[model samples]
Target: MFTKILIANRGEIAVRVMRTARRMGIATVAVYSDADAHAMHVALADEAAHIGPAPAAESYLDGERIIAAAKATGAEAIHPGYGFLSENPDFAEAVEKAGLVFIGPSPRSIRALGLKDSAKQIMEKAGVPVVPGYHGDAQALVVLATKAREIGYPVLIKARAGGGGRGMRRVDHPDEFADALAAARREARTAFGDDRVIVEKLIEKPRHIEVQVFGDRHGNVVHLFERDCSAQRRHQKVIEEAPAPGMTAAMRMAMTQAAVKAAQAIGYHGAGTVEFIVDAAKGLKPDRFWFMEMNTRLQVEHPVTEMVTGIDLVEWQIRVAAGEALPLSQNEIGLSGHAVEARIYAEDPACDFLPATGTLHHLRFPQPIPGVTLRVETGVRQGDIISAHYDPMIAKLVVHARDRKAALSALASVLEETEIAGVAVNTAFLARLVQNSDFVAGKLNTRLIPRHQQALTSFPEPETRTMATAALAASGAKFAPDAPDPFDAISAYAHFHPITHRRAIRHGDRTRYYAITGLGDGRFAVRSEEENAETLVLPAEYGERIVPWPGHLTIFDGPDNHTFQLHDPLEQAGLAASGSESLRAPMPGLVKLVRVAPGDKVKKGQPLLVLEAMKMEHTVCAPHDGVIAETVAEGARVNDGTVLVRFAESNTPNAGRPARRNIEPSRL
Candidate 1:
């Protein structure tokens, strides 16, 4: 066994690996980039080393620098967690050449399954059924287009070297194939530096099911059952559950057998997940599932597998890397209760689930609750920044219970209790999704989110009590960001006798007025327009009912975290505001392409430029028919709210455009 090891990753996965290492009495080393200097993963390591700058290419993805850090720290081996260099065969080979153990599959095994086309061929040779697709080496346009036609309409063009939904596209008709293929290649080239692609038949009502398999150097392999990742948005998984809700005995037997066969075929070791696409249009059967691809390392949703199987996957990875045999036979491994995991992200669902980035000024998660095994796997603290330099994931919230119903119920409650500020979050969206009728009943698929987007994406208004709480906060009863407590003297602001005040708060599109009266002794009477006066006591330091900062305050509500603006009277009377028009960046990103320039005439919704951030691309479009005055140069790094394109001085045409408010920095 290794006395100490180095983790070649960042964020939650790194922190997760360190936890297992510490528990096993093994020291761990962590590597960080300039952006992650104060990150949670770096602080949790027994030793740390600096890699390079903020860009992943110069830091996390720099395999040589990572190996050097491992050697300098005297780590016996290196664990490539989930992303970064986890599945890179060249990096694995280099680590072996450096006289250190690479705590994962051998380079040969990685190469066998690194590309989707080759992996399909290998799986077919091993008798593991693969999805029907064009796995050819042809890269010409006519060749791919002909293949798509032969496979029929509604085909999927996927980047051979991509994952996490990047460099993938769906074409519904023959006319759409060319554009989709071009887009997929562009994304693939940017993300993986490989533009090769494969065309596959798009399955209807597809339920994504993956089996967790482990192998050892002794050629012993076992299965850890399966997880259903059907609930998704934009081809990215949103919610996952283990022991697929409607799985049958016969199907489970067949899937597990095939998974073990695939791993054994490649002589795989350590952790691996064999993903499959099931045709749920009918139902799960022995022959309905087809192998999609194999992930050569751990997945982001590994916690759900651990919850149901009562196993430590990270520990298993470490032990297997040390040449230990399989811990248990296939028959000894059994599934217990159900487990569900929801990815908590800093994103806004209303705007098509765009990822958000900012400092986490105030963050709160749930504690260990009763009757549920809760695991909050995260690498971010309250003050850490969810920067654009990396993924915007905050944590993975996992819960296990006796059944799927109980598990879903518990997960809903936990999401409601989660409080976050300074960034948009998908907490409300997740809370609603768990209680969704189809989701609760397990009628799941990749289209679940997109089909029910209206109900899931619309943010609801605050309740009466929540508004009353906000009113109390704005009254400055406990703490205030403006003047000191007026109740202390009651001279000028309080009118010397009946201390009364009125506040106007602006929400989405409307403003509400509240009448407040100071009742003394940390109490206030607050009344809205339609509701009667309600007296509520303020907890010490105002509690978490409301979070007040410089210019705004956050109120926790059921449907959303309602942050209201208490506008200053002087500022409102200044002017109607200059309405100069310009297209600004929604978040910090790199300008990938620029299609418009000064004096260029563009139509509404015309793609003017593309901004890439967090591995997702969002196109900045013209708001209305107008002539562009100036545009930001291509290849320039920009921050949130930076003007990317400006309209001519007298050519401001915002027809059919909604009023612009404060732009929240978010993901693509």
Candidate 2:
């Protein structure tokens, strides 16, 4: 094996690689940007180097800087973790040119599958079934429109040069084709600098299944089964599982063979994933699957494959890079148990799923369970900042159990105990999803999330029994002295004068007041306008702060507890609007595109501006029907709450004029 290797990435993946390298006695070097100077991965590596500034282009994506760092540290190989520079073919070639091994597929193999259009053509030659689409070089409007018609209605327009759900659009009919294509090309140019696109037939209720294939320099390749990544939102995977719940032996065999064939076509070595989109409308079958794309590096959900098969993929990557064959063959790898992984991101699920950035004041996971292992791979520690310069993923919460049901239960329990403060996360939302009846029954597809959107976003209110228990616990020690008038404090003032105590509790939309009545023995009866009467019992062995944070309380009733997050009532009184009628920027980011001008008229819900932040696109919409008063030029960098546009009261002749501007929204 290589004595020392440079990790050309950051975040949890860097930490993950360092861990495996440590286990195999290989020294690891980490590269970081200014934003990640204090990151956990940097501190964990044997040596660290600063590449450039905070932005990805200046640092992580700077191939020359990464290569220099690797050589300066005397590293023999570089492992590009899943995101930045992982799939960049030029980076792979650059590392090899510098006499350093890229611990992944060869540059030639990466280039073979680098571009979508070219990869599709290659797959067609290999006899692997591919989605019927126009992958030609023609760019004329009329020609592309004809191709869309030939493919049939409901065609998908995807950028030929990029992935990650960017530069992708679906047109359900001919009338929507022109605008969709224009918008897609604009985003494609902004994101990848390539405006070329391919049209494909859109599959409804598609289930995404990807086969994990690994090879060695000896030309030996084996498949590690497949993972079902059907649970998605906005084209991003949220939950994943290995040994698909409803997979049959015949289908698995066929998919595995196809995956191996694709690997052999490229003389691939190391790890790569061949993704296929299956038509789930009629359930999974061998013939119903078609090639989607190939991820030319290690996947984010690789842990699920590791949990099922008793093989460490990272160790294999190292051994293969060291000129060794795969440790195990296809037959040697066995799916012993089921594993599921939930991606815990630093984003809010309720508010358009916008990415959030803040300091992590508190982060903790409960003790791992026996017989089922819970792995939390994270890069941030308490008090560390989550910046907007990188991906907002906090960690991948994975669990393994004997069966799918057991895995779901274990995951739900772990998510509940996982506490993250300062930055809003989707932990509670994920817990609700795993415990959902439909999810437990394995009625899964891409639409599962949208089908259960309401229930998933709406959290359950605290149970009465749980509230009562919390009240009892919050009351602290109970007194019953042997002396007379032991209840003096209660009796002296206890004329049943409606002893009411107000405690603020938040459930969903708003925080409301709760009335408490102490019933002896650390028990109390609680009532809210929305809750029924419930009893609470304090734990026999309790602390002043069970949940370990003040201003909030978690009451363990008979068998459950409810956590009530408290909000300061005075915060709203101090709130002030910074600007005039113009809509302000909600976060710091570059203005990717300006859709409106200074005097363009727009309707409600129209897209007015687009901001690129945290490596994702967010659209700012018009709040009401009005004429545009002002707008920032494209590519302008703006801070949070910087007004970019102002609307004038509409004065269309047909329709009466809008009300006066002096009248605010509430008054109007």
Candidate 3:
């Protein structure tokens, strides 16, 4: 094994790689940008180096800088974790040229599968069944349109060089083909710097099943079962499981063989994943699966595979890069139990899964149970900030059990017990998803979230108990020290009668007045507009407030953490009037395009600007029909809630004409 290796990435994946390297007695070096100077991964590494600024292009993607840092630190190998430069063939080649071992697939193997169109052709020739699509080299508008029609309606236009759901679109009709192609190309160019695309038939009710394959320098390869990544939102996997719920032995064997074949055909020599799109409109069968793409590096969902197969994929990657043979043959590898992984992201599910960035005032995961297997893979601390410059994934929660049912139940319990504050998160959404009847029954597909939209996306109002607790905390109620019993700690016997205090608290969209009365002897009576008065005992301490806000309180109510804003009398009076009209950014990001100008008329729901953040684009629309009073230009950096466009509240149209829709920005 190599003595020292540098991790050419950041975030949880970097920390994950370091953990294994450290355990194996290998020194690890971490490279960071300005934004990640104090990042968790940097603090965990044996040595750290600053590459460049926060922008990935200037730092993480700067191959030269990364190579120099590796050499300066005397790293014998470089492990490019799952994102940034991990899948870039040129970067892999560059690492080898610098006399450092790249701890992944060979550069030649990466180039073979870098482009989707070319990879499809290679798979077809290797006898690995591929999806029926047009993978030709023609890059003309008419040619793509013709191919989409030939593939039938509901065709998918995917960027030949894209992943992570970027630069891809689904068109259900011929009329929408042109628009979909144009949009796909634009996003593809922005994301991958490649405008080439391929058209494929869209499978209905598809389940994403990918097999983990490993290879060695001695031309030996083996497969590690499969993972079902069907639970998704916006074409991205949200939850994944190993030893697919309803997988049959026959189907598993066939898929595993096909994966190994694909890997060996490309001369693959490291960890890689062969993703297959399964047509589950019927049921999972060997013939119903087709090749989607091959990720030429370690996957984000590799933990689930590790739990089931009892194999250390990272350890194998290092050993193979050091010219070792395969650790085990295909016949010897077997799965023992079921494992499930939920990707906990700093995103608001109610806001269409918009990525959120903020300081993590308080963050905690549930402690492992005695008999249950629970693992948390994260690279953040309590005071760390989730920045817009990188992916907003907070952690991966993995649980293992004897069967799928036990694993799912344990996962749901773990998600509920997890606590996070200072930003909106999808913890509640994930808990609900795993407990859904259909999900529990293993009836999963790519459309699971969309099919259960109402139940999964609706944010519930705070319970009465939660509100009462918030009110008491905001009113400065504390436990009295000179009490005979613990229950009487909050009761001050100085007053013979109960003392009443009124305060206003805001929870979501509504603010209500609550009357809190101290009954002395550690008891208090609370009354709110929506609930009857009730007496309750006070605990010595409420939850802590991680943020520096004076009256803001983060209280744990059962499994969920509720953050309530204490109404400020002085600041509430200066709020904007109901008639005020302005379009503000919902999150901090760079203004990619502004479609309107001052005095331009716009209609309600008309897209006026596009903001790019967290590797995704969000459209800001006009909330009402009005004329633009002022607007910002494209290429401007803006913060969350920054007013990008001001509008006149008047109902009259500008220049006696309605605004044209041709210039409206596309919806994300």
lDDT winner:
1
TM-score of every model versus the real structure: 0.92, 0.84, 0.93
Candidate 2 weakest lDDT stretch, 10 residues: 659-668
Model 2 over residues 1-668: C-alpha lDDT tens digits? 79999999999999999999999999999999999898999999999999999988899989999999999999999999888888888899999999999999998988878678888888899998999899899987788899999999888898887566777877898998897887678777766668899898988888889999999999999999999998887567899999887998888988999999988888999999999989878777889999888888999999999999978999999899889999998888899889999998886666556677777766776679888988887887888888888888898999999999899999988887777766667887788889889788888887788789777877556655444445444433233423264331221224655234556655334555556554544333456545564334343344532452455554322112345656567743333222235666655778877888877878877887777776556777776788987788899998766666666653332121111111111000
In every candidate, how many clashes are there?
2, 3, 4
**Which is better, 1 or 3, measured by lDDT?**
1
Q: How much lDDT does each candidate structure score?
A: 0.84, 0.78, 0.83
- C-alpha-based local distance difference test score of model 3: 0.83
Instruction: Return whichever of 1 and 2 wins on TM-score.
Output: 1
For candidate 3, write residues 63-180 as lDDT tens digits.
Answer: 9999999999999999999889898889989999999999999888888897999899999999999988898999898998898888898888998985888878889998998878
Greater-TM-score candidate between 2 and 3: 3
Runs off by more than 4 Å, candidate 1:
463-465, 478-485, 488-497, 500-504, 509-515, 519-544, 566-577, 600-603, 649-668
Question: How does candidate 2 fare on TM-score?
Answer: 0.84
